[model samples]
Target: MARRALLSEAWWQQATIIPDNEREIAKHYTLDRSDLELIMRQNKAANRLGLACVLATLRYPGRPLADGEVLPAGVLRFLARQIGAPWESLQYYPLRDFWRDGKQMISA
Candidate 1:
């Protein structure tokens, strides 16, 4: 969510900031624990969704559509290919799980 990826920054730049040229990077860029946490959560969610799409495709072979459902584009094709389904029948879009009807909200 937050662009806090600073592999270029120094590990010991904090103590030597401003006055010390060695820690000059710390002045230019700031990274904290919360930034790291956001990155981690985003990575986890992405990995989980990717895995879920794969599993869904595997569960339903040949037919990319679950029932009367239609998938958008990108992710669908990827998952379909992952599970040996027809890419043409696949769709990729954002989906949200709804508890009320056990349904998914697919975006167009």
Candidate 2:
């Protein structure tokens, strides 16, 4: 049987992005110096970005990233700049979704 969604798409959309406020972005997405050091240890620009984004999602949303998740622009900018990466480098970070056994897979 196909799995069902636990929440409405509309609600998830709302939940995914911070409201583009500076204070809110800072509050939710700010990485500590320790986390920044850890993220920077990632080999590639994309890897650094991916790790930081995953941490941000877990910090604010209390969950790991979902497939095709769109983070807030301000939050993305915050994280990329904090990591010393070009904001557009995000294009190099691949989506985590994968196909397996005739189904789209999400990690538990």
Q: State each model's C-alpha RMSD to the native.
A: 18.8, 8.7
lDDT of 2 by residue, 9-31 (tens): 99987886545788888888889
lDDT of 1 at 61: 34
| Model 2 weakest 10-residue run by lDDT | 95-104
- The estimated TM-scores of all candidates read 0.21, 0.68
* lDDT per residue as tens, model 1, 17-89: 2222324323322333553344335223434334434344343332233455443455444434433445542
> For this target, which candidate reaches the highest TM-score against the unseen true structure?
2
Q: List the residue pairs that clash in candidate 2.
A: none
Model 2 regions lying over 4 Å from their true place: 1-17, 95-108
